[model samples]
Target: MKRSDESTYSWLHRLNPDPYSLAVNAALLELVPPGLRLLHYTRTTVPAEHLGAFAFYHRKIGPFHLDGIPEPMQREMMFVIWRIIELGGRVPCAPMGLLMRELAETTQRLKTAGLPFQSLTDRTPAQWKAELSRTWVKRTHAFPNPQTFRTYVSPLDRACKILWFTYDTSPWWQREVWDLTMDPRIPRRTQEPSGQKAIHWHTMEPAWLRHGGMYFVKSMMESSQLAWSTAHGAKNALVQFARFAMARGLTSPRLVQDDRQLRGLMMEFLTELRSTPNYGIRNRDKPRSPASIGQITSTVRAFYAFMHDYGDEAAAALDDDRWDGLSPEYLRFWRPGDIGSSKKEHFDESYLYSDADLAKIKAAAPLLGLPRAEGGFGDPQAMRILLLMMTTGRRINEICMLDARPLTLLEDNLAKLRYQQTKIHDAPDTIFVDQEVIELIQEQQAWLHAHLATIGADADPPYLFVSRHNNLRGQNPYLTHVFRTQLTKLVDRAHLTDAAGDPLDLGKTHRFRHTKATSLFNAGVPLHVVQRYMGHTTPEMTMHYAQTLDSTAKTEFLKYKKITSTATESAVDAEDLYDLMLLDTRTDRVLPNGWCTLPPAKTCEKGNACLTCDLFATDERFLDIHKSELVSLDSLIDQRQEIHRERTGEPMSENHVWLTLRRREQQALSTIVKNLETGGSKPAAALPAPATQAREQAGMLGGQGVRTGHRP
Candidate 1:
């Protein structure tokens, strides 16, 4: 065997005496085709590509001798094998032996059976052509993609030519010489003109081109110096418009000069856009969403308006007033609901992560950065970015674009991150992150520093988020999409769900921002405060992120009405409130001195002395509370009576006011206790208690005819 002590062969030579390496190398040499034998290199350093030669031979080309195969078949097969091996292969030699044996057997059978299309020596021209047609049909049916059937036909014909040469008495037939120099999948040519080509503007009639329509677009591009992407979009839209016009035999700009025709054309284009699928190269059936349709309409409208000013000397023809229905204002039908209406219905509530979902994500967060050997994808940067987005509610691009300098180690275990806001708003530049996020950042910094050293000086970047491998190493990687993909994996692993019982979706990373904002609002943070926290310029924009759930509303409204007569006030316990709202579901409740005016867990906007307002329903349940309050009020009334007795002539109006108010409260408590002791009358409907009404009317009339006596 040929061998050398080169570095490439060192590993092989070290194991030379080993049976497995010797067996593998022997099998590879026998399995590789004769013409392809030059591909194997055992003496010098083999390029990374030669490692995959086994798979290339087995998958793309058979291991048959070059002389055994016809000339045409040999050329095409050799080209495909060379191309695949050049890219690199990963098949082991042992499995390659089995695969190559199978391929060799198959090729032998094909060679034995003559060509699928019989030669002219054994059949007439028509008969031979018919056989060739059937063979083409069979091969086309066997191919995966029907669109590429024509592309594969030539190579298959070349393979069949081998059988023809082996059996037929006639000479090789002349055929079209198709190049097998490059893989068909690699785009070798493009029909699009070099640089940014203008639509067929020059082909229009001289009169129409002279009308300034074409010149208008050219001037706009030159004057505004439109961005490359923007100019590209405008050109594409105009080209599509030209195609539409040409199909209808309205090639000249003059054909659409009439207002009615122009308006009709716009309507037809929009309707077509609404129905058309978003035709990608691979995915041809995905329909354009409402937003996409809206964008097309807006672009078309802008193009017309641009031409109206610069192209048409008579600007009034394409003015907003002239083309009433085709204006951008009419394109607003795409988004549902009016601007001021509640945006709650627009999004799927299940998309937002809940507290339980958050817990699951936290548990799964560590697994994101674990090594692949430990069942992880080994991307700690993705984990750190996702955690930052979830906790900070910052935009994906904003977080990805941050530099190491942006992270500040603040006092009191807090960390502040500062980045310039790109949304062009009045929000602050800083965000306060917690200790957990800080720890993640510090860990990433250490890993990055170490990795940079190992990768060499070229792999060190000032940006915090850098790609770890390939051409992207040491660059601002813009890992927002990577963060999203890893986040989805974590979500699936955690099995998170929404309130609606649907599995949560992590596709829209913005949901994390909205989730954080909504949580802050539900925590009773003021709207303006939440706006600042989320770095939103306006309260309206911040409100868009907050959700109004029934549970949150019930909890906050209950706090507003938790009043007491004592100096210290108390609110219902959360468990009690939940039980009252869900488990019990009863409408009746007894207050300290009167009935509760509110429904079970429902809010009362007017929160004051419960005895005064209507809707109070009391029974034996409140007996002890009412009796205790009655005794206290009675003692206070007697003191007021003593003070009134010392006043000259008549008691002061203020003293009468005090006596009347105390007496009313005392009566309410006594009635409640009496009803309880006697096993109660039928429970009262939610109406005003008697004494509360009398005291309120007297006080309203400047305490006129107020009673100073303690009748109760």
Candidate 2:
């Protein structure tokens, strides 16, 4: 190709082909299978160099590795398209309306597939481009907008226009640009002193950036982009800190707004740094940290980074001393350790709820459509939400993320309160809720439904609690702080105070769990059971609560109390009790290994380990019973196959399950034999005693008068 033609091809390759270059080839080709086969079959090629460059750019733009989208994703997409075509049977039009419908269907298919997708590397870049061209094109515009865009371009515009006005004469991309000058809601442009028109660059507001998972920062620029003027190194760390710590309730977003606290914190963090660290911005190549007074002043320099980058005149205003080297200030906090009036008041609830005060909190966030209930706290979700936490002991995140559906009741008719990973330190992903909590949940769900309906809100986010800050303005989507803000208001109104009647001692989500553990322990329920109910991941954590419970002793005494109360029980003498003596194996009396081989009870006579003595001793036939049970996997497999053959009239393919069971059975037998030797057990009527349990190793029976599976 000629240089000019090759250059044009380069431009075409660099160009995003959607809705324009894609028009060169139709979006769909009839009678072709949906995916890569279709892609490979249709699109044309480019040079290897061009393909490599394109691949590099794709990676640069995204987290794309050469691996592309996964195979399962491709298969899923194919299956969906195949199914859609099989049912509907044709390429619908490719215009804006149909294009949108096709894209939506494709997306829905991808979602239902629930698989990672393949990327450009799966096919050659040239072939990928060709496919993109063919798939995105061939659609007609729904209506001519005269601005040259269609009726339905994505609400997220395809093109990003820089506000730099001097670029008007400079070569710029016009293919994806749209004319938004007609919209009144958008900023109106004016001529600059340079006699040039400038497109406006708007400021980014504070929002909780929602993305999935943890990964390392990409570049200094990306880190800086998180905050308006954060030092590049501080950016990613700050983002991570905000996400992880805020979720943990260790930090709050309010920190960003408090200038004094933030400045002081920055100074304190700087003071901790004795020397320069590798992550620095000035000498990008060198590994060092800033140590001079300017180390703190770096925050000041970053204050206007965004405005400067955007060519905004407001950048000049940032030079003010408010962010300069921190001024001396007092560290007086209301918490006890800090030099302030009161310590952090914990939840005590000593403030007696007046007969009237109880009525107010319950009435604060009232039911929707109830008469004389003015719109104050809005929905009753907040109040009922608090009750659900305190009563049910669910984590705040679990409650916040709960779906709008009624609780899922299982076969036992017990309602389940399964939650995904929540903010609680170690709360389990699923919890089967108590019965009373289920009723509370049902009532809460009803209240939310009515409230959402009145407000014309759909339960889109599946959040149990909604707030003005987090929810859509009207018929929109959710924001992050909605539940956090709502709960704060509820706590303030509820008069939930500390033991000392301290006003600020409101409870958090975790406090409910703490209360539940305390209550359960106090009620004499076993700690292990509570741990299971609470879904503790480890027994160690469970023991912490278990230590508080004296249920075992309390229950024994209670049992005796009942026994004494019943005069009829006196008829059973001590002789009758001797019949039920299983030889108490409580830890104190049981040998170290939980058995008794010594006369009376095993005590280390040598002050040595039990291995030294094997003297024939058994006050037992107690725990060690003559177990002749044979768990034969081969027999089980044969039996299973016979049943299967009889039922299905097909031969058995493999006995993989039986094989695994047989190995496990052998392991269990070995463990049983080993434990017997250690306990010095003299078991009764041993294996091979039963005709059913006889193995080839221990043939029928020996010449002995008694069955001789036991080693005497």
Candidate 3:
């Protein structure tokens, strides 16, 4: 037995690792394969990574025997290490710990065999080749991730010291080799790495650690996320938020997610959901998807509260601690996977029309038996409904809920539209109608009056924006289903499109509201002004009206913010943004050589200045303004890709889509952490257990608009 306690065995434990001439290193010129099929480590971190003597040095060479590493692999490995050094790992993934495990096991086996091997050092190059040919090599292909295996390395620390190398040559084939080497010798001039040599890695940074409770919290939350509440709905929301989060290039946001914090939050919510008295929930009568119910309510409420804090003073005023330490009993749950009991028959967007599309539709109404805007006032009435949407930007439901009888036009042309409906239904929000919108409403009323005699003025629906029931009013009703039917007929008959004949998007009626918000801002109206136009009692709801159109709208939108532009090619320079972020990079974070490509490089493949690169970096500005804090942005990108893979199961494209996807992912993760801290996840041990966590992991994000994805 290789006595672990003996001081001489210290090197064996650290470098050699195995006594069996295991595949990692070797004993008597033999390799150790994955022979311990039954053994498992408890409470042990995988691969013994991220700790102890290895933390500072953090990399290793081998008890290096040359068998497992094929000859072709060496050169390639060297080259990769060189690039890793140059790139500072902006490349994202460098699964080093996994690679080192393969090296360690192979080395241990070869060493334990204790065989006297031919010395390649003394032999001629041909002799070395001959001996290599004569030697028997047993190929045991490594695990996909060789780093998962772990050993009881120590009492306080179980992480193993993994090797890392930066080499040059074929980056593809020698990826494993480079993953194993120390840092290569970097040349000073352009800061390139030396060829074919491996030195110790000097990252001089701490390895990412989410230990013990932290790891457990992540595991539990991730596991339960999709299963809780509405699984599928949450999944979609997660995708949206995750994409955004990954694009946000900051580590500070990541620190907020710690283990104990979230575990406690989750535990509390789950416990409360199944509390002894059920927290006075009235609708516990209906069957529910147990896995998601508890966590989803917890998560959403937590997020709403968190966001409410970040909102303006008015929002803060509405926030209530009255339900202090009280878990919100679930009121309603949209079934997971499917978007409720019915399909998307009524929620279709056809009732919505853009301003231009509505104009075209209005023009065509005369041909379809609907009155033209000029004569009988049939099409004109429809026009009034559209103008209302454009002015108020109210959702289709909100618009339908309005009873115009309560609205009175003042001499100033201001329409005082009052209604007691669900605008933050928990509280009362007064609606203020703008003047231009009031005029449109008056036009709609005149059209209605003309049509009222034909359709029976007293027969229209209670809702102001009645759809299929078009002119049916006073007592008769029009449900959303009517809107769908009428909308389908209108779209089919109108044949609306842009002048180029590209079919205009007309399915969404709510878009009139979106259009109102978007158009008002594009016309140089302030967001707050757009907000009042929408009748949002609070600024938070008002902000939702904000948007930037692709190109034209952006140029015009800036004017509202009082930001003047000279029509320069750059609307907002990407380099300028990077410089601001890099203005204060993390302490001791290392940056790569091409930190800013503008300083000029020694004539390589694509040596154009950063601004001209496909992604377009103003490299000179990046260096000049942010040279003091050039962090290797590799990790952020890596985390982004990884989360993307986890959520969408699709790799991102190379274009700026990568940035878009990453930013969302990072934000979702940030939201999760915040919910964990103030919401639940803490005191996880005390909570009443709910369904499995796997559901919540996949399906908890977005609010009432989102769907939950979990099922039995």
> TM-scores, in order shown?
0.46, 0.31, 0.30
**How close to the true structure is residue 453 of candidate 2, measured as C-alpha lDDT?**
60
Q: Write the per-residue lDDT of candidate 1 for residues 1-712, one digit (tens) a residue.
A: 0111122122222222121222222333343455555423222323343432442343423223333333333343344444334322122333333323333343454456763411112332233334444444555554234443332232233222322222222211111111112112211111111112223333333323222333444444445434322444554455545555656667444346554455566667666665666644444678766655555555555655555444434334323233223333333332343112322354644455767777767677778888989988788888787788788888776677666556787786797888646453346878777787788778877877776666442344656766553312354344455677777887677666655566667777788887888778756578888888788787777766554443344433333223222211224443354345334344233233333434555766534444433444343433454555566556655656666678665554644765656655566556556645664343342222213434333222112222211111
Question: Which digits, one per residue and each the tens of the lDDT, describe model 3 over residues 1-712?
Answer: 1122133223223323332212222221121122211121111321322111112222332112223443323322223322332222211112233333344344345456764332111222233223322231334343322222221111101011121111122222112121112323211111111121221111111111111112212222344432111232333222222222333321322222453343344344344434422222444444433433434454443343433333243222334232223222211122243222321222222333444565776575444334555333353334454445545666554544556454776667566775434333233334567677666656555554555555444434344544333123333222444453445566565666754476654445656665566566656577666666566667666555442232232232222211001111233354443343233332111112112222222232333222122222221211221222112123556656687789889875556564654344334333323332333232322221111133233223322211111111
Q: Please give the ranking of all candidate structures by lDDT, highest first, separated by commas.
A: 1, 2, 3
Best-fitting candidate, scored by lDDT: 1
Each model's lDDT: 0.47, 0.35, 0.34
Candidate with the larger TM-score of 1 and 3: 1
Better TM-score candidate (1, 2)? 1
Q: Local error of candidate 3 at 420, Å?
A: 6.2
